[model samples]
Target chain A: GEEVAQTPKHLVRGEGQKAKLYCAPIKGHSYVFWYQQVLKNEFKFLISFQNENVFDETGMPKERFSAKCLPNSPCSLEIQATKLEDSAVYFCASSQYYSGNTIYFGEGSWLTVV
Target chain B: AQSVAQPEDQVNVAEGNPLTVKCTYSVSGNPYLFWYVQYPNRGLQFLLKYITGDNLVKGSYGFEAEFNKSQTSFHLKKPSALVSDSALYFCAVSLRTGNEKLTFGTGTRLTIIP
Candidate 1:
């Protein structure tokens, strides 16, 4: 079995277009986290999920960024009408415990908004 | 809100010498501190974490972190640096529980000069 995996390691999207990234967390992991790191900006929490349920999404952009963690399926983070500000490296991490311990990160999906 | 600060944008160290990457955290509750390393164009790889008990936590690749409650710092250190140790390092903090969201520093690029 492989570790956490992400698809489309790189993505380029025009402004006003939609972009989606996918992540398959390690098997038996119950918690998944998403983060966005813009150039020179801190790695900010975008969302977190416990199984198929949303645990936290306070950092999500109210308008367009959405995410989902399906049961036994790869998780997804979709950005609609991408803006230049949305361009950044999006990372997905998973942990077996709910306590944010022993988390593992994926290769990440680099999104370039043009 | 929780956050982390990596004071140095880049840390330069000579191979075979000791190295330190400074990190400080601001969080409301007891912190679950972690250190991760990333190579160029790669995702973060967990180094070590400070959950409780020991102040000194040892992790992968000869890297370690010391969690100081009074200083609110969780600095990563390496006993003897190697050229391969050069990479981008990130410090993150979380609440006691795994469900809590993680807050990461901007990151520090460590360059071990051979």
Candidate 2:
């Protein structure tokens, strides 16, 4: 694909339910990143992958949030036992290089935890 | 660590007037600066980036930014404003090495009044 693709444009999940989002990076891009945008208009970095390996996970919440990018599959971000604070728009972005390169973003997945 | 700051929470300009949005950054060394725009309910769209060489960088939708090394600033600019150009703008910064994640500013809401 020419652009990063994200699945489930909008998802309404009850509190304590699980929410999963998917992302397919643009063809030829090796670096994939996930960000969470809350209502405050702040973009918080969640995680990033280089090829199929985890590049950085410092921003991830280890207790309940997990992500993976496997061979021949779209990357996934899963939130277990979602809370109201978990409601946000999850954006997937990709870049050909980690430095001095343009990173393209997807339309984003809107997750509303009620 | 790299950080970005967008000083204005909102900016308004007449449709025909020129517009500017302020941004400043701090990093240990040389930085990679970028600007992104987000329309309502949409993901962040790449506007422009400043890697090296030119102090003035042009990007999508007639947008441009001037990077000032002394001021540590990379402000977004447009020759003329359009109502359609009204959106949320974010400035981001990343180190030239080490970090793969971009640190984004709080975001500025640009409203072009008709």
Candidate 2 chain B: worst-modelled 10 consecutive residues by lDDT: B93-102
Model 2 / residue A33 / CA error / Å: 0.4
Model 1 / residue B1 / CA error / Å: 2.2
Q: State how far residue B104 of model 2 sits from its true place (Å).
A: 0.5
Best by TM-score: 2
Writing each residue's lDDT as its tens digit, candidate 2 over A2-111 gives 99999999999999999999999999999999999988799999999998999999999989999999989999999999999999999999999745878889999999
Q: Write the per-residue lDDT of candidate 2 for residues B16-90, one digit (tens) a residue.
A: 999999999999888999999999988889899998998999999999999999999999999999999999999
What clash count goes with each model? 5, 0
- The model with the greatest DockQ is 1
Candidate 2 — number of clashing residue pairs? 0
For B1-114, candidate 1 gives per-residue lDDT tens digits of: 788899999899999999999999998889899998999888889999998888999999999989999999999998999999999999988888556777789889999999
DockQ of 2: 0.70
* Model 1 misplaced regions, further than 4 Å: A98-100
In model 2, the runs with Cα more than 4 Å from the true position are none
